[model samples]
Target: MRYFEFILILEIGILLLLSLFGKKLLNRRIVSAFVLVTLVAHYFLEGIRWQMYPTYLMAFFILLFYNHDFLRKRKWYIKTILIFCLLLLAVSGAVAKLVPVFDLPDTTSRYAVGTSNFTLEDSKRSNRKLNMKFWFPTSKIGSPDGVYSENPVQTLDGLFDMPGFVFGHLNRVETETYNNAEILNDSIKFPLVVYSHGAASSHLDNTGLLREIAGEGYVVLALDHDFSFSDYNLKKSDAMTLEYVAQKAFITDLIDKVVPNQVQDIEFILGNLPNSNYNLVDHINFEKIALMGHSLGGTTATDASFNVQGIQAIVNMDGPLNTASIEQLELPFLYMSSFSPDISDKSLEEKGLPDAMLYRRVKQWELENVYRLHDRNTIGFHWVRFRNAGHMDFTDVPFMLPIMKTDSYDEHKGHLLKSSVILDFIDIHLKNGKNYQKVKDQSLEWIK
Candidate 1:
């Protein structure tokens, strides 16, 4: 249990004991003051969460009743109310929040990180307003808000049509990235890595990798295409056509609409960064920009790589590109995948542990996408499929909840291993020229 939770449990115990004997201690100012002080301290310290209001009311009411001789009932009903309040107060703190802390990785360089958000118009898609998030290297580390998102459970609950508690403590996850840290002053230009999230996900979906990479002295920007609570349009899920699901009309709509919409979002970020008023723009080496994302966002990254002039590479995490126009693609690429389609079910029940339906979909998706990757005759692409990682393992969701993690490999180690591989690939293509064949041979299964 967390410090706050323990404190809450103790406070509830004291409150129950006090109400029964509060009348005896009423005239004693110090004891009365102590109880009242603890009550206010509890709420004020956490900054007055709305969830604590009921407990606050009950505690204060108990105090008022005990102090007033007329209202102080030595009756069964009074005891019942006190007992009820005590239980409610204790339970509130337990199920209230997780207050997650980021397990920040040690950096190779002395690093500083900063973030900035931009809202712009999506001209192609009815000029809808869009939001962008950025994480960049700074000269001196700055103080961060620590929170990555406000209420993730509610946002995803509505989208996935699942219970909110599936991701309980989702809102409590704190980010280690500093809020608008001072931009690095060095003259050497830094490579820019633009991040896109999976469909029905926000810019924060891959925050763990983004922060880790930013610590390695790269400028990372995670754009939020749909960062609102008002009925998220999950149309992007249809953006890529799986061989089994490609015949549906919605798949066509996905190709024509959602794919372009995401590609445009990446382009918009690239276009806006050159003249961006943010101090870090001076450090961005526009000629060495790259795009990466999970799932649908990966597809977007691949699409962006096609037209974007200065892009040095594209990193797609378990997401297949929707376009059949991969023949002419010249950009260097990094493709990471979960278990392939051919893996057996017995192996899956022990390793992946996803629901039966999800496992089926993943296998089929893998079959089609793997075929696509094979058909593309590109010297620049390096595809890696982890031995036993679940589909969510490529992203941060599994790491967020240890219980939910069913991947055969440990989530953190797997992610760290992947991040190291990614940094090496970027080092070779974007910054310094390095041989990746050795590292690739040992750590990854070379696909095609």
Candidate 2:
């Protein structure tokens, strides 16, 4: 159940209340106006289009019934309004039932060294912390199907003006199915890749991408940036209020701080993993470590490579470069952007941050081995524009939202294209041999 569904139930309750207390509030135009306003607000705010017509009919019933005392005298108008409202309600109910509400193909895989609560001391601050979950390939383990966080429902509830029933039902619901890791013959140490999610996003937000990368014989370590994007309980606010604040800050200063902090977190994880009780060290080919992130996380990947030693390559998935940070980075880097110069001017301004500033900054950091891709560039970049892609498309939420008939991605095709491009870029840069001719052979469309 979502907040919108709760609104529907609330509306039903209101209708019942109106029936019981009609005579008491019959003369109160303010009450009627308040109901009407709430209906309109629900329609626009929750995308509950079907509810509008029925609500209008309900309003008509209240207006007509309140004026006439005898059913015999107002039989025609009363009956007509009742019939219309019932019909509209029935149709709306049918439409809601038939339409898909959410759609993310759930998947999971088992690992022996799937440790949690691996804490690291923050280098920059006192009494600070970082936590990570390492899912390394394992053998002979009785791992059940995995489950995703209940945060999404809580998040939707907080963001939308929906009811508690919808969100409360989803709180901490496990929603993923895991399978045994795919076996490989003559298994050797796998490549290591550190994953960073966008601001206000949880590590589980990109499970679809993480599982895919892990399935490809790479150890994908996702870092949870404290106070950055993961769930935070504000000392003064309630749970709902805190969630709202966290979601809003996800794209703002919260992300900016998370990006740099993620670098430190990754370095800590890597240094400690080799010596921890968990056998992650034996599974990873540390020499081939790569860093990747979506949006702000992508920027962090770029910056981390400079700060963290032994990071061979970095991939930025639709993430803009910080001009100051880019200058310091010297490793092989790949910039995968959805924007193109031909698309709407709204692209650069709306996507994440200012494009002109990012463009000028990235240009200064462009090295001979650096590869760049943008719209319609088949050889190097994915064939899509930033205008069509939402910042959320690169994650697994889009797929799930589509199935549940929730508002996730603007377009399914664009989301698929974005994910595919990101997977391919990772494959090329992380899995494939470094100094591969493909990077140099690619053409560059230098946008001024």
* Candidate with best lDDT: 1
Q: Give per-residue CA lDDT, model 2, range 97-169, as digits (tens).
A: 4432334443333333232335566555664666554444434345434444434354333322343233332
lDDT for model 1, please.
0.65
In angstroms, give how far residue 79 of model 1 lies from its true place.
7.2
Candidate 1 per-residue lDDT, tens place, 216-285, comes to 8788888876632233343434434343454244434444556677788777767876886766677888
Query: Candidate 2, TM-score vs. the true structure?
Result: 0.55
Q: List candidate 2 stretches off by more than 4 Å.
A: 1-101, 105-124, 134-144, 150-186, 228-258, 345-387, 400-416, 432-448
Q: How many backbone clashes does candidate 2 have?
A: 17
- For candidate 2, the per-residue lDDT at 58 reads 57
How close to the true structure is residue 314 of candidate 2, measured as C-alpha lDDT? 76
All candidates' TM-scores?
A: 0.76, 0.55
Itemize residue pairs with steric clashes in candidate 1: 139-184, 144-179
